[model samples]
Target: MLSIERTLLRLVMAALLIGAVSVSGTVYFATLEEFNEALDAELKHVATSLARYRDLSDASSAQRPAGTGRVAEPELEDSEIETFTRDAAGKLLYASDEKVRMPFIDSEGLTRVSVGGESWIVYTARHRVGYAQAAQRVDSRRAIARESATRILPPMLLLAMGIGGLLIYGLRLGLRPLDAAARDVAGRSARSLAPIDCTRLPAEITPMVQAINGLMARLDDSMTAQRRFLADAAHELRSPITALRLQLQLLDRSSDGAANAAARADLQQGVDRAQRLVEQLLQVARTEPEAQIAPMLPLDLGSIVREVVEAASAKAEAWQLDLGATLAEEVPVLGDRSQLLILLNNLVENALRHTPSGGVIDVGAEMRDGRPVLFVLDTGPGIPKAERERVFDRFYRGGQPARSGRAALGSGLGLAIVKAIAGQHGAVVELLDRVGEPGLEVRVSFPRR
Candidate 1:
């Protein structure tokens, strides 16, 4: 591909060359026409002046007689000009050059004739006594026109060269910003997604720069989210793996059957915890902002709430907690059923894990102000207002200790997944202290259709 500067220079030079040629050709033809006209007029005037001397036959060759209708001949400094006179019988009377003789023709204003192997233009004027003719060589007339046309060449060439130089310089100057931008991008490390500076960019290139910057910003955000996810996964996986290792060691050391069985149970619990952690991590990944969510369909929020409550009731009973649901009409919302199921499961599981035994955990849905709102209310010790926002961060357990006091077996990704899924459905999730109660209420509000 050609460089922009070279291409622009080529185009400009071509235009200038064409223009110069056109102007030169036009001027050459126009000058030739005007020169021919002037030559013809001079020839006619000379012939007319000579014809005024009607009695040329009576005059001596030395001088014209006084008052004999004689006209003083103009001195011919140019050797190319020749004049001659002829009588009625076509006999030559006098000639400007002794060797020069005018060509004979029946009648003529101007005519071309061959004289001594050279082309000449002659003009003839008839008088009462004789005819006079004035002639000039065609070669001399052509030389004058050629000289006038050649004079235009030097200035035109200089002008074209000067303009070409200016054009090249202007192109380089105009493209400097783009060159700077390319260099800036090339010099960056692969990890760098920083925006290219547009402070001094030209207006024509500003949109392209802005588009590049926008892509850089999105890539930076995606990379950041990926890094955070990996770190959180590593941190969250370490504890359960360590616990599983310890349980295996205990099982190996146990000699008695009771001790072996206890170790086996502990091992199974550790495995289960690790498995749950892995599942939550996967859920968090699936719900990432960059991930494509499952397609949405119109779903009944109330039915979804009831289904979650029914599924978790057995687990709630095992923990001696009351799991129930309140359906305040068939709350309709548009969402991916499986993702909403995951969202609801996380909310209820979080409530069950945090709430103490015999605590009441209620899942419900309702339509409020033309929008569907789903909520989970737990009778557990609520999170502090200061820690509410941080709880939505991946692997971030709130500052408040778990109500059960035994090490909580919950992965901290629950609320993060909840938040992500809510956002995917164009819903807002908020954690607040249950009104007039010492518990937490998590609410998801969906946009109205």
Candidate 2:
């Protein structure tokens, strides 16, 4: 239930903080390593200078052994003398300051030395009077670098906080459109299905807005269809229901045998009509989006077609219309059995209702293009090319044929229910030509999964 902006801002801030912490840790470590290398190189250079001086001084003293006592040589600079010393076998000799300890490595025999604090290398060699050594303090540099790096983090953290706050603020502003869109959706009614505007939205949310808008459009169509069906259903049932009540009253009040019989017959007809209308209404309601579907089972399309043909046979006989199934072998399909039956019954009933007396109605189901195709074809006045699409719309009946004989008794929801059923099953239903005659052919194709 969090607002879009707050949620987005919080997420972004968390990510930034994590990244900053990680980068800071990496930089601190890398800086420590670089400082250690630089310090080691500097220490080695200073040590090398001292070693060269020691070699020169020692050589001079050796060449003038007699003059060493007679002629006094100027004292060498403190920087050019050894702070510590080792013998020929590399044992510790002496120290100048407490800070000057034995070289990290043994300072005798080998040309290079390595050794402590974290280990460092020292270089040493033989001279005429004494041996000289060059030492490298790699660990001292590492310690200083680590300390400086640790010290730098607090300021970096403050800067990152400021930058992160600014970025989160900008992100919230950039995402304002999504917030507005969410509010727009929240404020809408259960019946409202209008599309949201996306022209002024940010690019990041444009596609989401567009998708919602498209869904809204479809919902609008569905709602419109539902409302229309309800209105038409009410209209269709009202008259018959009223007639049935009036006929029942007359039958109850009647004294004569002939009058009572007539009233009873009228009441029965009205009741039948009302019942049919109610059943059709229920079917239409099942097509609504909120309607739940039962689990699908393997049902044969041919069996459904045959059952519909058989159920319509009596009505077909009354109209003097021939109704029979021309199905091949069982055409297996995965669907809800009762729903499929209702679909086929509606289609076949619709065909028989429209076809003229002596007209032949062919109900068939077969496999075509690796899909199950169920069709109902009848020889009657066919729908025009312009009105074929309109006929599938709920409560839409063509001008010429809708009011013909008992066809006028229909609730006009039959074709719409058929279309809905086909759509639910991921099938396609289309009206086509009945061979060479002037009649309608309704073909429903259900693709294999």
Candidate 3:
């Protein structure tokens, strides 16, 4: 749950700390090694000088017991350096300081020895008379190493701290665009579904921003469609409900049997119109773009058209219209059967209602350009080219009057439902004037399998 800037800062600080520790450890060990080597060299040089003094005939005087024939301590820069000489009989002869006494060591070269319960690095050299030794305290060597580390560590720590601060500041500055994007989203109203700005965005975050923008665009479209459907439903339902109410009022006031019967019939007709309008409104809502379409399977377009024609036969007989279908082969297509049936029914019903008595309504399916094409050709007053587009809109009736005076039979949602269903199947629906005729040809061309 850590913020990006804090996470980056933590990683940078941890790296800096590790680097500081590594550098400090390297410097500490190197300084310690060099200091020890220099100390050992000084001890050896002093021991050699003292041995040479004894070889120059001072041995007889230097071989005496402790506190006798004392030699002046070497004029070394470090006062911690102590010098002494011992005889072959394991007794100290020459002493640079009277209080400094060390165990007699006959071995040569550098070695650690304890004097008065303190550790020192002693270097011994044998002469013709006795042994000469030079020693330095272990504690003094440790103190020098400590001073060296102190001198090197403070600057390293300060540099690491400064780098860490700068890294944190840089991380914060780099993430400012994300912070601004979040604030922009937070400040928007609930109704605001506009896409977020992607300009100046970092490449790493651009994909996320684009996805968010795409989701917002889809949401905006869905909400707009919902609002439009609701408004249209309310507007279309108002007229039938008002007419039904008036018819009911008239029936209630009528006392004559004939007048009561006529009012009752009028009321029934109004109720039927309202019920049909409600059904069509439900259909329109069901076909909204956001609604999930049923899965499509391979279906015979010709068979579907024939079935629709058979189903509408009774209505066609009542209207005295010839409703028949022609199949150019099986004419296979990929579609949802139930939805396709609804589509055909709506087309045929629209054609039958618009066509005059004795007019022919032919439903046909055939292959065109390696795809299935279904057409409903009606011998009726076809929709003009200008009004064809508007006819497919929800509850939109044509401006031209119906030849059969049966416009009221339709709720004006037939073509809208057709268009929606066609869209779901990825089909193209077009209304065109029938060739060499005054009728219309409505075609639904589906994609090639």
lDDT of each: 0.84, 0.72, 0.85
**TM-score on alpha carbons, each prediction:** 0.63, 0.79, 0.64
Please state every model's RMSD to the true fold in angstroms.
Answer: 8.5, 5.3, 7.6
Reference-based lDDT, residue 318, model 3: 88
Best by TM-score: 2
Better of 1 and 3 by lDDT: 3
lDDT of 3 by residue, 324-393 (tens): 8888778998889988998998999899888999999999999998989999999999998899999998
Quality of model 2 by C-alpha lDDT: 0.72
C-alpha lDDT (0 to 100) for residue 76 of candidate 2: 28
Candidate ranking under TM-score, highest first, comes to: 2, 3, 1
On residues 1-449, what C-alpha lDDT tens digit does candidate 1 reach at each position?
Answer: 76878887988899998888778878888987898898889888888877776555444552333223334578456426787777676676667766655576548589999988989999988877667888888888777777877899778978999999999888888899998998887887659878988988999888988998898888888888898889878887888999999999999999999999999999998898899999998888788776886778998998888789888888889999989998877898899998999999999998988888879998999988998999999999888888888989888887766658433788888899999999999999999888888899999999998
Residue 435 deviation, candidate 1, in Å? 2.0
Native-to-model Cα distance after best TM-score fit, residue 119 in candidate 2, in Å: 3.7
Off by over 4 Å in 3: 1-167, 194-214, 254-258
**What residue pairs are clashing in model 1?**
none
TM-score for predicted model 2 compared with the true structure: 0.79
TM-score for candidate 3: 0.64
Q: After superposition, how far is residue 339 of candidate 3 from its true place, in Å?
A: 1.8
